[model samples]
Target: MNQHFIRNIEVKKVRHHKNFSIHIDDTYPKHVIFTGKNGSGKTSLLEGVKSFLELFDQYSIPALSEWRDMVRYNEKSLNEADPSNVYLTDQFRNQITFFSDQIDQFCKKVELDIKNAHEIHHLLEEGKFLIAYFNATRTSSMLTPNGVEKVSLTKKYPIQRGAGDVFIKYLVDLKTQAMFARQEGDLDTANRLDEWFSYIEYNLKYIFENDDLTLHFDYKNYNFLILEPNKEPYDLTRLSSGFSSIFSILAELIMRMESSRTNLYDVEGIVIIDEIEAHLHVSLQKKIFKFLTDFFPKVQFIISTHSPFVLSSVNDAIIYDLYEKESYEDFSNYSYEAIVEDFLGVDQYSSIVKDNLTEYENLINKSSSLTQEEEEKVQKISTYLDNAPDAHSNELKLKKSYIDLKRILREDTI
Candidate 1:
């Protein structure tokens, strides 16, 4: 039998702090969700997982070159003939090359005796062992042996042969603009690009109208089209942000699922999604959360979100608290997914929180009669909203929803 586990995550010499760790027990669910305030190291923690995997695949060396003192350059103290003096840049470059060679030598000595059969399995458990990262920073071009070149969609490119990515460039294009154009010495490829553009222009009308999604691709090169798959193109501005965000997420999840299935029982696989609820509608948020339960049922999913709508759909999760104290002290808090599971189970509670947030939005927009006690509580929640950050609007919305639910529950007792 094959088994997979994350084991643990540890960080060092990173942006946030000197050190931090997250330990997961076997009690973790196959589908996991993580909720925390912004800047709570959620993305950083997820990056740890990706970084570790990249190390195993030898793709992370460039990013981590500084850590190993691999950068070598000239030293002014010694002459050029002797090992005395060298130019700073040359010394830095030479040291990096030496370190890389040393590390490769070390790996050869150590890797042979160990087994890594579970590496692939663990990663695929979360969908597609080949990590497909989607964030705002991804660019339109990636360096290749030939030089920087335009990326293609609809067909695979030679430069992307070793990289196991399918469709990330399309997601990036969702927020940007993409059009087919001819490149030097490649009219056929340009024509192919034109065909893809024509197809996208004709078939993706609905997505364009919604203006909520961005598409990306990882083919001959990386490209973002700022479009989604649709039957017809609509005015990009009219589409709902929530809908488009969910569309981007769902598309990626589905693609990953299909890819993961090709290899079953592999270890060292995981899917890390940052801000899983970005720019999505409330209803779509809830639906997407629920839908994810079905999409990658066996894969381990680690998603970060500030949206309560995203929280309500999770059956099990690890909640990390990033609150701080005034005396320059740092501490963190955690809650099991079970607490969230039970909290969202009440009928009034679930109904108000689970559905696409339109219902709650309508309720908030309408007036409601309240008793003295009920009125006082709603007032308190509203007041709390005054001090909350703008990024926490969803948290406030959830707070208000609970207040309304409490009011209804209290009236039932009377």
Candidate 2:
């Protein structure tokens, strides 16, 4: 089923800096949602869809030049401050070098649009589609050039030459003695590297079978808890920075959906989730948008959110509202009704559902028991935020300020 479609996207001077453009309506409810705030430019519009998913290798080329140095930043004074100012352009300029020195040693010249830079780099190099930048390197850490501080991914493919570095060195030596018995801490080599990373995440992608594959992870106590009977390892910094940001966004969307499967929708990819309701838990941000609407329904998700439960159970998602445009070095001539009234006139979706329903009713009254259907769904969201009123309208004032932020998380658990 090898599919892909991203219709439109544009960003410039990158991070928080705008010369923005966004258009997507590739028909049907393919489901996509993105609201904004924390450094708007929502992950620099997911680094222009991971630089259009590294022009289709779907990830390779040092994982798209280490995700274009994570939403590009490096303008050694815009090439020594405007060295004849050509900057960077590709929309099919051909000599295709969209700027680098590993993104100029960390995010610099991220502004684009030179009169539609040769027709948006020839429609993102003819939409082989690729773009997925997320959580802007949350707490920035990545090391492994043998310095090994944390950036882990080298069973081999960081480069050893071809066949995807010989199948990542034969799957790290067929799971290198269970990935060094769980990185040498051992508990039966970390339960055989957590059951061979859950059998390469349930036998790598759909050769067919369907039940939409299932497994978003929370394996009740992890280090990779392969059926945690009592092994207790999950200390990726004591899980819960919203479960280590949903295990670093489900390990970068299951290794970019199991390295471009080569066919079934042959890696056309597009994922732009920024602040996708960060540090989630409005039921794991509604199970991360119902696991990206039924696990990558032919991938093409654009997200930037301030959350109205990630924009009311998104359908064919599209809503923009970025402001500021004094005199175009950029916020790209702002207009779309001043970007949806600068995010619904700073109501910002009722303060992102009153700060995620006060952290989802304080993680369900500090979870010890709940089952009677999460106590009648926290008593019908505490009787509709104690009988709504305060001039409610911005979607019922974000559903009664997320039901009085889940009744101040059940009054701080009484």
Which parts of model 2 have CA positions greater than 4 angstroms off?
Answer: 1-49, 52-248, 253-281, 286-303, 308-321, 324-386, 389-414
Cα RMSD to the true fold for all candidates: 14.2, 19.8
TM-scores vs. true structure, each candidate: 0.42, 0.26
The TM-score of predicted model 1 comes to 0.42
Q: Write the per-residue lDDT of candidate 1 for residues 37-153, one digit (tens) a residue.
A: 455555665555454544434333333445354333222222334434446545655665666665454232122111233354334343334334444222222122222333243
Predicted structure 1: lDDT: 0.43
Output the worst ten-in-a-row residue range by lDDT, candidate 2.
156-165
Give Cα distance to truth, residue 201, candidate 2, Å: 14
Report how far off residue 147 is in candidate 2 (Å): 34
Please give, for residues 89-139, the per-residue lDDT of candidate 2 as tens digits. 222122223444434323342322122122322333444333445553342
